[model samples]
Target: MSDSYPQSALREWRAHMGHPATLVAILGVGLVLGVAGPFGTDVRLTLLPRIAYWLITVLLTYSAGTLCDAMLKRPLARFGFWVHLAVTALATGVAILLVLLVVNYIVYGWLPDRDSLPAFLGTNFAIAIIVSVVLATVHRQSTPVEIVSNPVRILDRLPLDKRGPLVALSVEDHYVRVQTTRAEDLILMRLSDAIAEVGDTKGAQVHRSHWAAFEHVTTARREGDRAILTMNTGTDIPVSRANVAKIKEAGLLP
Candidate 1:
């Protein structure tokens, strides 16, 4: 999968964390919350301290959420949404509450009263469920690669972002580097089997280990008895003498 596209729950969360936009989001949301000072934080602390408080709290919760998502995946992968939400809320709520105990102590100089512990836990659970649902929704947005006429079996092996119109395929040991208009991916499949899955795409195996789509062949030039085909992606594929006729027949060469 592309690092940008959302995938499995944990992986998707991790990928998002690596994006620059995620940092922007974290900083923006922290600033807003600090200014607004939810739960009386604005009243309790000065402006700079308020911003610092929310910023560190935001950072802690984000780290806790990532950890909780990973920990809960194995147990919840087979479960449905309600079960996931309830369990996720509990797990993440507990994890964050533990860390927040220290944060609260540092900010306020003491924890909430023992009698108010349940209320604190409840607040954590509510926040956890909201964050869980949003992350789950992001994870669900990934679309699987679809292939062939009915569905190409080989294209399914490529990542979602790499699934586009056919370009070329090249063999590298046990793997075939499948290229589409969008990008290329190395799939663990034979060149022959990959070509069989080309379906409606008009292309030919121009070399013993290379295949080129006719529509994507940008230049075809004769090289003595053999030929060279340059694809739209600027990949030059050497066409063996035996396949020269096929390339010519496809009008890839004059």
Candidate 2:
């Protein structure tokens, strides 16, 4: 069950990080760095080597940061906003440093001697923090637009303008109440079927009567042996004892 946390977090991370615009931005930075040279290295290298170096470095750093983001999400969230930022910045910095070390060794046969590794790590680590902070800011600004453009298929039952990012679904007798960021409405359907139709939206049945989208969850709190998901809309949805492990594995609880 614990093993599933990383996988689920990684899936969620990929969903956000795989945006075409993000890829294009990373690629553009790499191209510019390659052409202009990083730390005056391009002046000594040919066009092909310079391009390859920057491209590989950017790709590796991006991948490492994504993985670190997934792994550190829950712990950082539990630690609160400021701590989350600091921890993520530090972890991403170390990851980028390591990636650069390996990439440089492979590409340029430049193995840092033991005496030089500390300075190399420090320099790359600083670069990593700056890059990660910038990327995070960009993603935050672009995310709302992306969410608005990509409508969820499961929300087709709602009116055109009413549909938004899904929040939660509650089963009320024979009908399922669909909650979105914009509003809530009832549609005749079983919770199980609704869960199936939700498709790629990351969510889980927290209780027999309730299903909550991971993205819409603002917090998760424990009550005795059960868990409760506090959604973005400020509604608290209860989690059954049976689903506690499932919710934890989804990284919805810390």
Candidate 3:
């Protein structure tokens, strides 16, 4: 589960708060709050306790929200927008509340009472909901970018310079040929293993011997009853008859 969770969380993060601009915005907010201090109290025994506190809180909250987003994605996809938002809010709220409790205890030795816990939880919930909504909007407005920018677990077998936006993977005897935008390399791994390593990159096995990244597909054409995908690098990949319908439903085929 741990192996799959990070990949799932990474995909969700890219879908929402993974943009470079969103990261800049988060850092900017952290800087403002750090200097200003909560409730305008800047008194500190240490050199930068306020700044540290603010930055830590921002990191924790965002991490919790991203994790919850990944965990709830599949289950919530079947529901309406409002239901997704509600579940996300509730889960993120609980995560934030727990994070705040730990952070407060560490930074100020403060613990909430039964009476005070409700108010604290409510405040954290409100903040989480707002952040989630704002980030979701930003994600919607931004242009779709490469989802494979992060280092892939499977690509570690290839040379460092060859790791780039994966174009496709083809089985060659006992080895798999990994084609990235930058370069192509052969690895002594089975196609099935390679596919599992591809993680969250949007792709499907178009043929028994071929899997192509959707983003790298430049054109989709039909050759008789079979489907063909022309990659950006000009490699034409054949799509098996059995997988043609699945690729069409994914909008990778016409």
lDDT tens digits, residue span 197-248, model 2: 6767888888989988988888888989998888877778899999999888
Cα deviation at 31, candidate 3, in Å, is 1.0
Once fitted onto the true fold, the runs of candidate 3 whose alpha carbons sit more than 4 angstroms away are 1-6, 11-19, 40-47, 137-238, 242-254
Encode model 1's per-residue lDDT on 26-103: one tens digit a residue. 899889988999988877998889998998888788778766765554455456445765687677777787778889
TM-score list, all predictions: 0.50, 0.56, 0.53
Name the regions of candidate 1 deviating beyond 4 angstroms. Answer: 1-15, 80-82, 141-254
Task: Point out the higher-scoring one by lDDT: 1 or 3.
Answer: 1
Q: List the residue pairs that clash in candidate 3.
A: none
- Specify the poorest-scoring 10-residue window by lDDT in model 3: 138-147
Global lDDT of each candidate: 0.72, 0.72, 0.71
